[model samples]
Target: MDLNTTKSLVTSKTFWGAAVAVAASVAGLAGFTVSAADQITLVDQIDRLIAVAGAGYAIYGRVVANRKIG
Candidate 1:
């Protein structure tokens, strides 16, 4: 709801674990046919995007957690 509450969730292991699970499922589903060609490329790109998003969330959580509440 609020910024602090969201930050707490983002900083928690459960949140990241869920995120990883969702990301992996999406990526795995897309290339489940085992085309093993462009499908690998697609999965790689999807994984990279997910990793970037997770890194961004972690950075944002750190920033928000360090902010002085006024």
Candidate 2:
């Protein structure tokens, strides 16, 4: 595979791992706190995470499109 494809794969994997970790941490915290206020904050955090992931995917697509594969 070309450099861009390789980089994209690695980046995507890392992003997914990080997302999972964040989700797990949030779940654990919610289990302990069990508060409505905390739940709202968690929802906001989830929205931010979705935006970040979307941006990452967009960047990956741009990089892959610009790369020339043989």
Per-residue alpha-carbon lDDT of candidate 1 for residues 24-59, written as tens digits (9 for 90 to 100)? 668788874333455456556656766799999888
**Measured by TM-score, how close is model 2 to the native structure?**
0.48
Please give, for residues 1-70, the per-residue lDDT of candidate 2 as tens digits: 5655544433454555556567657877878443555555655666677679989988898787966666
**Candidate 2, which ten residues in sequence have the lowest lDDT sum?**
4-13
Error of 2 at 67 (Å): 8.5
Query: Poorest 10 consecutive residues of model 1 by lDDT?
Result: 32-41
TM-score per candidate, in order? Answer: 0.43, 0.48
**Which residue runs of candidate 2 sit more than 4 Å off their true CA positions?**
1-33, 66-70
Report the alpha-carbon TM-score of model 1 versus the true structure: 0.43
